[model samples]
Target: MTTTVAEELRRRELERYILEMEWEEQIRTRQAEKHFKLVEDVFRQHLGEAERMTIRQLITGAAANGRCEAMVYSFPARCCTDGGRAIEKNLPHWQKTLQGNAKELYHVFTETAKPQRYGLRAAVVDFAEGFPAEIGFFVTWEPLFFRSDESIY
Candidate 1:
């Protein structure tokens, strides 16, 4: 049996499409592996050890920008016990869902920053398929007016 020219072209096109799809899948697999490794590294360290530079940078930048809040840390939502749903929904128990370094950061914030009138906030910073993909911890403080109004001198 002899193949027509149009049939030959269609076969080549289909083969090219399949190869492209496979390449895309390979790329995605590599990216996922890298992301998982990064997440693991973050979870393995205490916040003070792994994140001091990040915190300093965030605070410095916020101050330079004249902002009262800065996102000091972020991690994949998959690290959370509830996949960041609690944080996304703003639940009071969201801190309970935090794992590893995030939990440590929260504890340190509550113990130290909170007493100093600096606030800490956790929220889902990214989403995928209507679910949280990443969570961020933001350090916050009231501006002068609100601070004075509350007599937080």
Candidate 2:
């Protein structure tokens, strides 16, 4: 078969376009991997080996125990599993109880499939020059059991 000049030029152009797209995809993948690695390193740095093991145990325990719903941890305080509604109190009262001034309060939640078909919500209360208060709540289909009575901060 005889190849026309225009047809040959079109084929080469198509090949070049495909190569360019592949190269772009590779670049994007590398960038994403690098960013994720940096994030993992930072997360590891913040939590020591023992702390990481403890956290892992909590998560795994929750997944294993059918009755276990949520785990709570108040910084500078002991960890608890009674993740019911948080008792509402005035900000000033909390500040005094925390033994430090309040800086910021945030509520963060993430859906996961590992433990169960549920979402993990955390109330992070940052204190000045002190450990933050954190309440990790498990959100499941049964609102009656795992629902938080207090509004998320």
Candidate 3:
């Protein structure tokens, strides 16, 4: 009086698929170029070109810069579930959508980085000095709950 193994396997398969949400590992990888591209697109939606760029070399172009940006975002994504939105101003919903691994992605530009890090860019130097007041304000000063209010400064 032995239970048939084939029936047990089929039953188990059905039970597992029906009852379990297969856990997937969304191990985060930061693609900084895409992030910057999104920001660029977003900024373009809001502002015109503040500066113009010419690609003298195809071997080196926006993609190279994006590769650098990717490195910046990938250093450690401890803050955000995704890079599309950020979570500094109590905007936790914009946090890592997965609910645990998201991190503030601003360090990619703000930190006084060295070659050992992301290498210093002469073009980006000025952008860093004016950060908290200029660029940083946009990221750090907004509050999450009051969508219409500009309460922080």
**The best candidate in terms of lDDT:** 1
TM-score of 1: 0.61
Best candidate per TM-score, number? 1
Q: Cα RMSD to native, each candidate?
A: 18.1, 17.5, 18.2
TM-score of candidate 3 relative to the true fold: 0.18
Clash pairs detected, candidate 1: none
lDDT of each: 0.70, 0.38, 0.29
State how far residue 68 of model 3 sits from its true place (Å): 13
Model 3 lDDT tens row, 1-153: 787999899999998876433211110112223233444433333333542111112112333332332111222222224422333233445432322211223333233222123322111111223221111112211111223343222
Tens digit of lDDT per residue, candidate 1, span 53-149?
Answer: 5565566556444466778789999989999988988999998888987887788677656766778898889999998998998877653332323
Lowest summed lDDT across 10 adjacent residues in model 3 is found at 134-143
**Candidate 1 off by > 4 Å:** 1-50, 145-153
Per-residue lDDT of candidate 2, residues 20-56 (tens digit): 6665555444433433342233235444677445544
Native-referenced Cα lDDT, model 1: 0.70
Q: Estimate candidate 1's RMSD in Å.
A: 18.1
Ranking by lDDT: 1, 2, 3
- Candidate order by decreasing TM-score: 1, 2, 3
